[model samples]
Target: MSTKRKHEVPDQQEPKRKHVEEPDQQGFTRKNAEVPDLQELKKKQTEVPGQQEPVREKVLDHIYGNKFWGPYLSERQWCTVREETLGNCWDSTSYEKITHDSYRWGEDGIFGLSDEQQKLCMGLTLWNGKDSVVKERFFGLTGPQGNLGEDVKELYFYLDNDPDHRYMKALYLYPQTEFPYTDLIEQNKEGFCHSAGKGVFDDGHWQIIVEYTKPESDTILCRYTVTNISTGVQTLNLSPKFWFRHDHDAKHMTDVSCFQVKGDESVVSVSYQLEPDCCYATYKLEVKPGGEDIIEWELLPVGKPSYIDNSSDVIQEWKIKAETFYNSLYDCQWSDQEKAVAKGAWAGLLWNKQFYYYDVDELYHRGQAVENKVKTVKPGNWDVMERNIKWRKHFKAKDILSVPDKWEFPWFAAWDTCFQMIPFCRLDPDFAKHQLLLLLSERYMSPEGQLPGCEFNFDDNNPPIHAWTSLKVFQMTGETDLNFLFNSYCKLQKNYNWWMTNLQCSDKYIFYGGFLGLDNISVVDRGCPPEGYSIKQADATAWMALFALSMVQIGIELTRHNFPSPGDIQKDLIKYLKDFLCISHQLNKDIDNGGMWNLEMTFYNDVLVDQLTEQYIPIQVRSLVGLLPLVACGIVNFSGIRCTEELKQALQTDSIHVCDITCGTVNFSGIGCTEELKQAFQTDSIHVCGVIKVRSLVGLLPLVACGTVNFSGIGCTEELKQAFQTDSIHVCGVIKVRLLVALLPLVACSTVNFSGIGGTE
Candidate 1:
């Protein structure tokens, strides 16, 4: 539940429940006419002559209200909190105590790491009585159901035998800021426990005292004064649901409707899903004609209900339904909930309507009111949605300091996240632009345009697909920030140069250096010698080819931002592509070229010479690295989607057949998922989707993005639903982009831009 805005405005008659009215195309009701159906209200409207009325379902039609920050009225609060436990919970002693839901009391357990306590995993937020002030939002998800918290606690950190999963936590406690807490306390501090004390303790409510500012950064700052009684000391952990809704009643929750209307006599209706422990009733929110709680009023729930349940079965169940228990919630002899529904009338403001969610934690002593309110705000909702439209005003996390819940590092995918935000581009173009900026921005991006593989551990490696994302953001948004992209171009050149310099054994850098290999997306994670020696591979060469393609597109966008000609950058991309492929073609020759096929199987030809073959690359799922070059199609918009000619030249691929030779044919599978056959063994009928065992998902992510979907991946099914629903504000906004790219590119591009940021705000 949630709370309402502090100010009470002018009031009007609450529409009788007996007859609900339909709202107009603008989500408002006509002057006292029968209300329209829900489907009709959501229909697209045809703009009239010279009218600026917004159409239904457009981005403007939505007003984002953050579920977490909406709880504030005058102060800022932290969204996440930590500094509670160590990072090593798998120790025999600690493992025995933790459970799946250990988050209920463990320290910094949001992502489920039981050890390594230093920084609080919490950050703050402020709505300013206006709308929003969201810089970024990070989701610390891990394990099944996307919850690392449950896994660490219940699964005992899974570190007993597996050290690899040990890495991952909300806080590392950098020395820049240091705060302390009681060490394994055996005694309770008196003031810590809430009681009707002389000074600190109070009978109103239990409090969770916290501080986010470290004196060096703009972190969360807050104070507490709950309106409850019978205080509480700090409990182990608290988890509660907090989203903004209209709940006028302090005990339970209520919903209301309001919109901006000048002067009118109309009706409004509301439909809600009443649940257990949910109670409802109707009341008029009247502004005093002078200064009273009653200025105007109306009613419908005629009389007391059959009982208390929102579903109105007070005797059996304990909930209410909008139509079922309408009478019990309100005691009126005149109108009823059913009657209101029959005519389509509702109990809310006539024209303008907004919903209020009541806070029970504030009412009853309960869970994480402070941290939850500040930390976990869902983006693209009513609170921050409007603010996302203002780019310059939005916060940019260029520095290293941060509060938990605030996005410190933007963890983005190599290619999937970039193309996924197309629809979101329609909502906030600046956000879309920032999304690109956040990725290649001066922050996490290495000196080379290569964005870190992930945020926390930026040692060096993920897939090479940044150039594509940047070019996409530029084209999709149509905004040009030269300094932002050109500098990125410069870094990109450096990154490409590094590959050419370090990985090149003879000519271009091909299968020379070992790839970081995300989830093993390479043949053996490295190249092998013909005489047979496992060599670090430079899979980045193929990626360079695609990057060159996008580099050209980004250059043209560079010109729009008022930069000098993109000649230099374009030349570099082309030169790099040529250097890369010319060398790669020679080095990545078929088994005849004397290259080793597997990384871990044999050391060198001298060690294991019998297995070498013309086609046997010891194909592992990691072998998918070869597909990166294909992404060039989307970045340059080869079908005439790019911005300039100079840029286009940089991405010229005629000099090398990197894409052609690498992708001719290969059966890749996750480690051990497929049997690696000898080179002489050949087959045109290997099942790609089956071999990968992921239904073409992990295997074809790049293929689908580059518009090169395999037969299996191209076949559409309900799977699109899952791919489409990822949270636009927190994730890649894949679904949002898919929906809006065709309608208005500007508005939805922000979804893309923001997605690029990976909810790092």
Candidate 2:
């Protein structure tokens, strides 16, 4: 039997018990419940009937205190500093020695350090009145049932003599309302949706506001404001503690030895010499009643620390930027809620941006692993000897902008980066434009003219959507910078050539791997090439067709600008357009001839063409592959076409035919378009294709492709109009569920803007 008192400070000798398996009030067993993955969380929302609910409603409920205390008044979400020991008993060094490595005794750790030594370290502590006896006690979640396990250590604070106490008191107190009043508002209107919670705290009614911001600079800003609310004179002493963990990068332990701390009447500063040419500084403000202070913390290369003196100016500059950003949104006719969501989305994008450095050798090894996987099915052909050689010779670890969820996906994906630019272009066009160039830069792009699929896997192929993204950004911004267009065209042309040379299965069709970002949606394993035959992917061919069309548009732009290469560009553009049209015609002919189209079923599916037999069989799955033709379809004005009149007429004829095929085959109604095509659609039976059954990127591709169809000329029936309205409502209900699908309904309808129905302006 072990002798250990509940809530008492744990000793090393205390026997550890196995984690209990008790189910909580929510029926989640503590031991068995794993943190849900993204897919599982999404599935829970769509599969469960009542799981989908507006987060705003829940936030409002918390504010009213109907369900629980509002997040503003609670410290549950706030991160806490904890004391942690690195090595276990199994290590060469004892656990006791590891704990004492950085530990200091008495005043030497506090006030005895020299000014030069103090310049390298910083700390935060809660100090009580000098008269009281100091009592040391530990406070943290420390049980099998508690949030944090027993092994984890936490930092403790001392006030006067009271060490075992909650020193941080943050609460919202509004006299007029029965419950505390709190509002989620943008901190800087000019900034990319920096959200701040505004509330009043304490009986004295000190206004407490917490705001977070991430500038283009590497540092993250967390600002707190406390304003005195009471008229009477009051005295309060509050100190927040901070401890720098030595375990962050053990390779930098010698650098950690250079850390020092210093304090004055109004400020406490900590500094660390990170490298021979790098230093980091952290400052905490000591503000009184009626005054506000900002703590400026940043890690920078070794230089004169001007940010310390200019912290106020840095904060003001961000404020000014935020103001400008807010004013831009104000100019647009958007609801407060819609604007809030947009801001939040922008904030998420900004917050998630990180500067990542990769080791070329490690990346090369990872790429080799990917190539080995491919070689299992298609030996010799999939070997990445050239890529490995290129990486070993030219690649060096350098910082790059990583714009994905750093925790889930640290590396950038070629096509995912294009989608990332969509939101970023709205916030910062320069950054977005630079991102497009970065992927095509000589450093990132291979000598073979291939843009790497991702950092880990170089051989995998993502869709060629960079040109499409570029065109959209250019059109949105009305940017006429010739350099951007010229450079983009040149890079995109090389990328196009690489794809045609390496991926083309036939003159018209292209092959793609599973890196297209739609996982497990195809009939045959797209990642695995068939043993003896080339696989023709409808999506891959369609993407290439779109890529070719983008190039043609770029060429036309160059010609309009009178660029030196316009004559050759125009000739090349004409050839690319002709190729696209031929591919479209071939796909249309294949559907008609290959028995892939079920006229009775009225659905077009992907066909698996057997290379040896010269025969094609239909892949019966109803997926995005069927809708890629629509994405490939684009219309050019008569003036834009530089091809011969005969070729131009043939292209137009093919376009209209492809449009008809796409519109007719995509069964919006679940009844499969047999009766629904001839008669009025049963309003109840008209289901959005892949809306409920398979919720994926593939399902949303139809809505993305909606812009290609000329809806006005389609001769819309009364039933079709009614179905559109009904489907829009359904989409609106689940708008908060998926970010990509949220914009679909708005993009689908061209004539009438759905502004009244929460569509983005």
Candidate 3:
């Protein structure tokens, strides 16, 4: 019996009771026992340190305020093809024209921020008292000026960023002396090293740390920490710029909204009817030797500068929240340095998002006019431009996209976007899904089911990885969003039809197209072969096989999820599975005629065919092109499906035959030599295919091919059993690789005791 205190209520009266342990018989408490406070337990379970759950919930609910502003600004807007009205892009635009001339497409600056549509933009400008012009945008070499192609000549680091764009930070170092703009171009032209005998960072530079914080959904705060790293005092002019783009839409609003400086040059306000009336307020701190000098700017409503009086407190509070947000993502055992590296890598990805805008119709007509001018001046000099600008009437891009680099390769590349979305799925799945859909949309994709490879060349065939990435994003996000799945499947089917119709040359089901984005990898230009001959591509065919399999997966999910549609989904699903088997069959068919596999080389290679003579020659180069076939391997588990006998029979084919053939070459990919393969096998030659055999990533590719199949619903047919046996042999052989033996033991204690291969003891 327990007696209650004055503050405690009766057990019957209370809705919930506290958890307590019963005492043991020896007049002692039980081991690991204590009375738990219900209120404290509830608080500990529900409360996160940074309260990022509410922000994430807001993101899920599609609250536009939380995502209204972000780092969607381009680092370099000049020298892009969208800005050029005539001639080549690099020759028409320069760094000098960025400040005075209004851009036709988009805006750019140093560490900038913009809205979703990029109508209103804000960026930072700097002057170190020695340069000829204000450092508005980053200065880099043109493609003709640099030996290693175009590159940025500035030093910048991305520090931190959140998924919701709530808090962002970056660092840009500016040299205090006169910038070596001309010397950098000339030195890069001469050789790799600078001819002026000076590196860019070899001189004394000023470290400027930039950060953006949003306390409220409508308010944005910016801080720039300018530190003097020179020996003596230096004068600096820093301006936080805010302007509307000089496009067709904003040209009318320019007369209505003008900048007004108030309160002794500390505040700049802009009033507009269409957009929210905003004001920028600044607060500066005194500078000292080896000390930090701060300049803060707040962008909010015209009347809402309440945080301006105590901006330091607001900045510190948001900084603590950002630190707490990142700290919650790590485990207690991870070191601080390891966490910082992971954070920096993610920050770089988030900062690379840029607003890409290009109208292909505008480019084509303008290019046609430019070509006429060139033909009149120097006849036959512009034939290439005239021929290349023919089939680009359907491409038009105006959206915020992830780029490889904002300074170099600013426009979106179809293949690069696939890899970029993999990381983006972890950061923001909604943005990832949107990015995947944008490429397949009608605005960018042609009516003939052709997706633009990039801005420079629309006709070039990038690897068909969009379906693979769509399925990846689906699996990574726990298979939610059925609408995204359905839409992706429908659009991808059209793109697949385009590939089959345009790329396949021979009835042998071989594929060859212009430049599958692997430039300079082959010995000869695969895009433009020596006129009369065509090269059969191994990678292109393998990618098509993977695309067929991905379509099968998406079709299976759509049928399984009970999506309400009138059409026969299962029939289409069966068609995709059959397509996969056919493509795989053709891939491993014959090496002498037009097949991809090379028997003497013991690898896959592109088959070069002579059109008139009907000759097939294998270009024996052991590169990634050979190993790409392994990525086409996957397992399809058809357990809970209600299908007809036709669909069931199609699923029971020998899907693992390619896996066995690729795995047989595992012995040839050895360190020095092994007796088991020599004793167990019979081959004609023992030539070494590669020097780093079985040590590089090529060795592990076979393991990806060995997927454990389970045909639970369909009866155990002979072909199914054969595939299982082949896969088991491939799996056992792959597990014997030395690198995998050391790794698999730490992850799982499974043994490879298949009937064909011996024990791993």
Candidate 4:
């Protein structure tokens, strides 16, 4: 017998073993046979023909090999905050300036593709043979140039993409005639006059399709199919461009991005030599057009490729895999058309991912040799710029972040990223988890626990959705990764504390400031109300309520799982529940007594309180701000929660009590459609004055909040009876006396026009 364990031997044959359930790298349950003998494991690891590891395994391993190449290239890198060298971002960099200038942060181009870290990038370029310059990057108006803020004028679509970027595709229509670059700039600068540019149907254009497929983890294959949609034959110049992201200092730089070209003109090959002592990628491109008039390329690492399959065959095989992967994601039955829509939506989400790199420390200290050139382009704004960025010296971000709009935003907005992760959680939960954690991590989250809102201004207030989304993602992923739950909960506590300390109004449950991510919808800019007044926003208070509810749920989950300290969780849970009740009490209080709910109109509105006079002036604007409170509802199952004596006592506190379900005839006395509503709608004339008594969606929110519609408590038959017969229904100690007569029918018929409520010139 060997002295060492038989299973540990590198090359020892063993008999068949029984299968058992075990947790994998990502905590996903899988059924696999007992750990194979050392020899069998070694044999499986070796590359054998016609065998490849599953993509799910690759994702679970959390290795950088398969994810090295992706659609991480940004669609727009110009005019980004990182490149705002001048005091003004919009005026400092233009499309023409960016073409010739070097970007210090990242790179962008048409049909762009880059590695995970974006050291070197590869993208497509085109020329119609009549334009002044080749069309490389996308053309979009700067913030001030366009009538609307910033916009991408060209039409394009992200056709397809997998979670792992194993297979991806996109389409762009390029006109044969010169682009309308100068026309757009000149027209928008003068006035709102604009053109749609050259039409693809009338003007001779090329429908270009770009596709990428990975044959192996370390190998990538790209294909471009350009078809002339014109009646006559047309000539178009196409080139695949590759280059390293421009850097200034070479003396201290250890790893350099290098590119080498080889092979003949007919079949050209290029190699990207990455960091020293690491893998290098070699790609073969057919310079000559194939019989189908398409260009094809293959990228391979240093090792020999296992198969010599044709590009078409390889692409078709991966396309099938992509289809299978997407199919597995659907949990319920969906029509083919519905499935197609979902695929397009998910593709856009995955394709918009960009490699975001911003270092505030570098921007603040200006210590790095390459950072010396960072200065205000305007003559006298260096001091102003320094004053603005001085407080954010600890902020540093260098990660693959999901941007809201790569062309327009091209950076993270705190609230938008939280919403994006909801869909992203379905594709790659681990990556989604990483994204949420990245913001909460010490590198991004402030020392005071305020998450950086966006790249432009770190202190700008965004909606508090971080804690809510963190719990959402965790639940979506089968509630695995408790470490994520524990860590996020700890940080979320600090964030919640920060909100209470900073945004809350004088120890009241109401919160102030913030556009609440709803810009231009308010009467005045709610972020900056009239000088002597402070606007208590309905949406802001509702957001805090939701945040508090989410924290309580997270604390309960942690306690149930016996994570670390149950005693601590109980204390935190009491605090969270009490905070939620306080917020709910303020929201539910009568309008005459400083609450958001207006008893006469039965709708929530922002109240402008004069700081000195103490007058509560309600800004009665009908919008989503009033209805946001509906999202703050959550069911508390005391049966599952470890309800201690303290928990029971907390529930019995002021404004917090359990109530039985009650239903009665519909109440139409005080809540019917009023004369002022008819005037605002029938005449199409709007006035901010008068007691506006319109039955908007806000009136029906409380009725829907207590498990009546789209909730669990009400049975189908009983719900219909209550909704039809009952004048009022009360559940869980919330009021629902307002009638939904005019609003519900109007909304159902799609005849409820919001513009009628508030006139637009």
TM-score of each: 0.35, 0.50, 0.72, 0.73
lDDT of 2 by residue, 1-761 (tens): 00111122123232232121112211112222221112343445566577455543343233322111111110110011011111111221222232223211001111000111112122222222231221111111212212222221221111110001001111222121111111211222222221112232233433434332223221223333434455543322222222221212221122332122222434423333222211222222233446543332332212213243444456566656665655575537888787666655555555444333434443333311113121111111223333334455444434335356432344577888888988677766776788888888877777778887764456678888998888777766676767887888888888888988888765354444444765445557776756665556666767877887777666766765677555567667667766665555555543546422434334445556677886666666657765565575443422332334443333233332332122112222222223322233223433334221212235556654332223555567677656656533322222212233232111111011111111111
- Score each candidate by Cα lDDT: 0.29, 0.41, 0.64, 0.65
lDDT of 3: 0.64
Best by TM-score: 4
Prediction RMSDs, each to the true structure? 24.2, 21.9, 19.3, 16.3
TM-score of 4: 0.73
Task: Give the CA lDDT, 0 to 100, for residue 83 in model 3.
Answer: 66
Q: Which ten residues in a row have the lowest lDDT in candidate 1?
A: 745-754
Per-residue lDDT for 477-541 in model 4, tens only?
Answer: 99978999899899888899999998987529989756666644668888788999888888888
Model 1 local distance difference test score = 0.29
Q: List the residue pairs that clash in candidate 4.
A: 664-726, 665-726, 665-727, 666-726, 666-727, 667-727
Ranking by TM-score: 4, 3, 2, 1
What ordering of candidates by lDDT runs from best to worst? 4, 3, 2, 1
